[model samples]
Target: MPEPVVVDAMGGDHGPAETVGGAVLARREHGVPVVLVGRAGEIRAELARHGAVDEIDVVHAEEAVPMGERGTGGAASGASSLRVGCELLRQGAGSALVSAGSTGAVVSCAIRGVGRAPAVLRPALAIALPAVTGGATVLIDAGATSDPTPEMVAQFALLGASYARLVLGAADPSVGLLSIGAEPGKGNRLTRRVAELLPLLPLRFHGNVEGHDVLAGAVDVIVTDGFTGNVVLKNVEGAVRAVLTLVARSGTAAPEALREVARRYGPETHGGAVLLGLSGTVVVAHGSSRAATVARACAVAHDLAGGGVAARLRDHLTAEPVN
Candidate 1:
């Protein structure tokens, strides 16, 4: 009964197979309305395989943005599934967009098509990663702006803090700058400069946090450039897998218990990283995502869109500005 979430069916590693199946799953299992945007024939065939051809709507697209594309090409092409899906969101034909396409391309297309919220210098990808304290740490610029200005990084902290408050329900969330050392004036020139600017802004700056503290729950929000944040995200996933595998082999924990822990941190459970500071909701999932991950991505988009998260986030940032 709600507006359908648009999915770029040809964007992921498994293409229409996983994406379309995910759309069907979101509609049938989660009761979320979905619209698949991709090649009409392939989408229908995949939907038919799930016996959902009649349930979900399909919008034909002539192209798909390649995984390597960095937004310009994806945004220029009117027929790419990424572009088409973004247009649907921009035009109000869809409530939100869920894509496993290149994060750069999705961010690029969303900005060009759906636009950014007023006064947003650059949009960011914020991911809520589980912490050891049972609360989540919101990592901003988690792959959206690999290289951003000092001011942009400062704003990322603002966005990350606001997200912690609105979504994670953290009151007065403490913010940390990701650095090599916990001391001030640590990390590269970018981080060093950011450290100097953080205290000047309206935030509960918690100084610097080292790599080991990312999951230590020392801070509610962690702000860094997209490149390092992406590396951190991948490293966390790999470490989780490796440690759990070793634990299973050691027989210290039950296999079922280990499986549950893995599932808790899996891509399917979290869906994907959200592109924040935009005018509309856009969720970018793993390029290698399968049906379950895609379905969860759609559900995430639905909830964020319905909750008026983008508007609320903009207001929050305005109330407590970075600059």
Candidate 2:
């Protein structure tokens, strides 16, 4: 039997009600079992409201982490829902963890509680975006480590490639370094140094890729430092939302083609980003996630856990030294 996914039921914008409702939906629609970790009384109340009290289990967590507390020293303390959820994963109570909590808290607790995979210097947050040609393109280091070494960028390429194969089902995933220009020496010192290191790794190196190539799916995976990646991701998301809003306000009803395009570009439909390089599968959902987004996040966690993503990553990383 597959292990259950541990959900931080009290950690999203909507709290327990929406989180529990999403867990129920995941079980009903995707057949994925989840154990909700939060104040037992509140979680049970929400489950009872949906008449799904018997469908899932609830674990007690005394506190909840506030969104503002992230990135601070206290983010992972306080017996918070995310902290307890990570503890459960460490103890084998669950195979993976899905949280819409503070990304810093989740990342911190995961590293401290579950530890990092062997040979992995840092974990990366990977977001999959819709590709123009057909499949999806993965952007790594979305917001995990803001300042990364050139070697870390090289590791991100490997981690992203493994993800593309296991999750995106790409055969021989091609990797591209996000830079100012497509030329080998166009980026800053980091990109130039990483460019020289990428070909030496066990991946299909496609040289440098400009910003436009991201949506064009010029490569299966685009690797960059966390700061730049986060800025690019937010910009793309904001642009997509603005365009969709304009289409809605236009006199004509949104056509099916336009709606499909919106759906394809939206982040809510894709659940959220996954934190790679950890010993366990950890999914970080959007902070403003509602029930549908939570359900998709749960499904993503279950699928990645069942696919043994952590194990694959460990093997791939250990196979060759990063230095």
Tens-digit lDDT string for candidate 2 (13-85) = 8899789989999889888989999999999999999999888999999888887666456657778788888
Residue 58 Cα positional deviation in candidate 1, in Å, after optimal superposition: 1.5
Least accurate 10 contiguous residues by lDDT in model 2: 314-323
Residue runs of model 1 more than 4 Å from their true location after superposition: 67-78, 129-136, 146-151, 162-172, 179-204, 227-271, 313-323
- Model 2 spans with C-alpha error above 4 angstroms: 67-74, 102-105, 131-135, 237-270, 288-292, 318-323
| lDDT for residue 44 in candidate 1, whole number 0-100 | 98
lDDT of 1: 0.82
Model 1 Cα lDDT, one tens digit per residue, 109-177: 886778665556677888888888888888888877888988788888887876677668888999999
Residue 45 Cα positional deviation in candidate 1, in Å, after optimal superposition: 2.7
List of clashing residue pairs for candidate 2: none
For all predicted structures, in order, the TM-scores are 0.73, 0.80
Residue 50 in candidate 1, Cα distance off native in Å: 3.9
